[model samples]
Target: MINFSLFVATVLIWGTTWIAIAWQIGPIGIVLSVFYRFALAFVVFIIGLAALGRLSLPSQWRFVVLQALCLFSFNFLCFYKATSLMPSGLVSVIFSLATIFNAINARLIFGERVQSRTVLAGIIGALGLVLLFWHDVTVSLDLDVVQGIGWAALGTMFFSLGNMMSRKNTAHGVTPVIANAWGMGIGALVLLGVASLSGADFILPNTQSYILALLYLSVIGSVVGFSTYLIMVARLGSDKAAYATVLFPIVALALSTIYEGYEWYGTSFAGLGLTILGNLVMFSRIKPA
Candidate 1:
C-alpha cells in the first residue's frame, strides 16, 4: 500500500508540474530556473531532514554526483529547452519512452535481463502515448521539431541513466532520501556554475505566478515528487519505478481537460485505456508459461 501510494503521489505531483514549468519558462533563464528549483528543494530537504534528525551526507559521494548530473541537472536542462523546440505532448511522448531506456540501460549496466512482459508493456505504453497526444504531436522535420525530439529523447535517457545510478546507490546502502538530498545540492551547484558562466541574471522573478510556480515546483514537485520517486527506485527496481513516466502524462492531459478546456477525442480515450492496460501488463505477477 505504501509503495502504491508512492507511485500515485509521484505521478500526481510530477504530472501537474507541467503547468508550473510553463509558468516558469519565460521569467528566468532555463539554467537559472532549474538551478533555483534544486536550490530551493535542497533547502526544503535540509529543513525536513533536520527536523527528522537525518541530515548527514552520504559516505560515498561519487556515484551520487553522477546521479545529480543526470537526474537533477542535465535531464532538466534538456527538458526545459525541449518545451520551446517541440510540442509539450511530443515531449511527454518522448518521456514515456523511459521504460525502454531504463530497461536497456539496466541490462547493459546491471546485467539484469529484460523480461518479455516488460518489453511488451513498454511498447504498448509508447503506442498509447502516440495516440494520446496525436492531436498535438506533429511529424514535421523542421529544425525546431527535430531539435525538440533530440532534446526530449536525450533527457529521457539521462533520466533512465539516473535511475541506474540510484539503483547502484541503493545497493550500496544509501537510501534515496539521503542520496537525493545531496544530489539536489550538487545539482544546484552545477546549475549555478553553468548559469553564472552563461551570464544569466540571479534576480528572482517579480511575477506572482512565477513565484507561486517556483514554490510549487521546488517544495512540492521537486521535494515531494523526487522523494517519492527515488524511494520507489530504492524499494522497487528502477525498471518498475520508471513506469511512472508512462502514466504521469495521462494525468497531465486530464488536468488539461479540466482546467485548460482541452478536448479529448475518441482516440484519447482509447489511448488512456491502452495505457492502463500496459500498466497492468507491466506489473502483472502471473508467471510466464
Candidate 2:
C-alpha cells in the first residue's frame, strides 16, 4: 500500500509540474525561475524540518553536495531548457526513458541483477516514444529541437545517478527527508550563485497567481515529492521506483490535453500504450535461477 501510494504521488505531482513550469516561463528566464523555485523550496523545507526537530546534517557532506548538484541543480536546468526547445509532451516522452537508464546504472553500480524483461521493456518503450512523436520530430528542422532532445537525455542520466546516490545514502541509514532537505539547500545555493554571477534578476513577482504557483511547486512538488520518491526508492529499489517516470508522462499528456488543448494523434496513444507496457515488463521481478 505504501508503494502504491508513493507511485501515485510521484506520478500525479510530477505530471503536473510540467504545466507549472510552463506557467513560469513568461516573465522570468528559465534559469532565474528554476533558481527561485528551488531556493524557495529549500528554505521552506528547512524551516519545516527545523520546526519539527527532525533535521540532521549528513555525515558525508561532500557526497551529499555532489548529489544535490547533479540531481537538483543541473537536472532541473536541463529539463527546463529542453522544454524551451521542444514541446512539453515530447519532453515528457523523452523523460520516460529514465526507467531504462536506472536499470542499467543499477546493475553496473550496485551489482543488482538485470532481468531480460527490463531490456525488452526499455526497447518497446523507446519504440513507442519514437512512434508517438515521429510527427513532431519530422516537422521540426530547428537545431533547438535536436539540442532539446540531447539535454533531456542528459537530464534523465543525471536523475539516474541521483537515484543511485540516494540508494547508497539509504543503505547507510540516512533518512530520505533529511538527505533531501540538505540536498535541496545545497542545490538552491548553487543555482542562486549562478544566477548572481550571471546578473539574473532575483525580484519576486507581484502577481498572486505566480506566487501561488511558486508555493505549490515548493511545498507539494519539491519537498513532498522528493521525500516520497526517495522513500519509495529505498523500499522498492531504484528500478521499480523509476517506473513512476514512465507512467507520469501519460498523466502529463492528459493534463496538457485538458488545459493546453494538446492535440493527440493516433501515434500518441500508441506511444502511451507502449510506454506503459514496457514499464510493466521492466519492473516485473523474475524468478531466481
Candidate 3:
C-alpha cells in the first residue's frame, strides 16, 4: 500500500510538472533556472526535516554527490533542453524508457539478472509510447526533433544511473528523504557553478507565472515527488520504481486535455490501453529480477 501511494503521488506530481517546466523556459538560462529550483527545494526541505528532527547524514559523500549530479542536475539540464525543443508531454514518453535503462544498468552495475518479464513490459510500453506520440514520431524528423529525442533519452539514462546511486545510498543507511535533501543542496551548487561558468545572467524573473512555476517545481516536484520516488527506489528496487514512470502519460493525458487542449485520437486510446497493460505486467506475479 505504501508503494502504491508513492507511485501515485510521484506520477501525479510529475505529471503536472510538464506545464510548470514549460512556463520556466523563457529568458532564464536552463542551468540557472534549475539552480534556483533546487536551491529553493534544498532550503525548504532541509529546514522542514531539521524542524521535524529527522535530518540525517549518510556514511559517505561520494554516492550522494553522484546522486546530486545524475538525478538533480544533468538530468534536468537535458530534460529542460528537450522541452524547449518539443512538447513536454513528448518528453514523458521518452522518460518512460527509464524502465529499460534501469534494468540494464542494474544488470551491468550490480550484477543483477534481467528478467524476461521486465523486457516484455518495456517493449510493450515503448510501443505504446510510440503510438501515443505517433504524430511527433511520424513528423519530418527534423534536427530539432532528433535533438529533443536525444536529450530526453540521455536524461533518462542519467536518471537511471541516479536510481542506482540512490539504491547504493540506501544500502549505506541513508533514508530516501535525507538523501534527497542533501542531493538537492549539492545539486543546486553544481547547477550554480555551471551557470556561472557559462556566463548565464542572474536576472530575476518578473512574471507571476514564473514564480508560481518555481514554487511548484521546488516544493511539490522536487521535494515531495523525489522523496516519494526515492523511497520507492529503496523499497521496491530501482527496476520497479522506474516502471512507475510509465503511468506518467495517463496523468499527462488528463492535464493536457484541460489545459493544452490535446485532442484524443484512436491511436492514443490504444496506446493508453497498452501502457496500462504494461503496468499490469510489471506489477503482477511475474517474478521480476
Local accuracy of candidate 1 as per-residue lDDT tens digits, 1-289 = 9999999999889888876776688777899999999999999998999999999878798889999999999999998898766545446656766777887898999888878887888788767766765554553236776677688889989999999999888888888999999999999999999999999979998799989989999999988998999999888887788778767877766665665555677776777677667766866787743
Question: On residues 1-289, what C-alpha lDDT tens digit does candidate 3 reach at each position?
Answer: 8888998899889888987887899768899999999999999998999999998887788899999999999999999999888767767767877877888899999998878877787788778867766665575455676688789989989999999999999888888888889999999999999988999889879899999999999999999999988998988888778767777866766766776566677887887778667655766785665
* Index of the highest-lDDT prediction: 3
Candidate 1 stretches greater than 4 Å from native: 86-90, 125-145, 257-280, 286-289
Q: Model 1 — TM-score against the truth?
A: 0.88
Comparing 1 and 2 by TM-score, which wins? 2
Model 3, residue pairs in steric clash: none
Q: Quote each prediction's TM-score.
A: 0.88, 0.93, 0.91
Residue pairs with backbone atoms closer than 3 Å in model 1 (clashes): none
What are the lDDT figures for the candidates, one per model?
Answer: 0.82, 0.80, 0.84
What is candidate 2's TM-score against the reference?
0.93
Give residue 201's lDDT in candidate 2 (0 to 100): 72
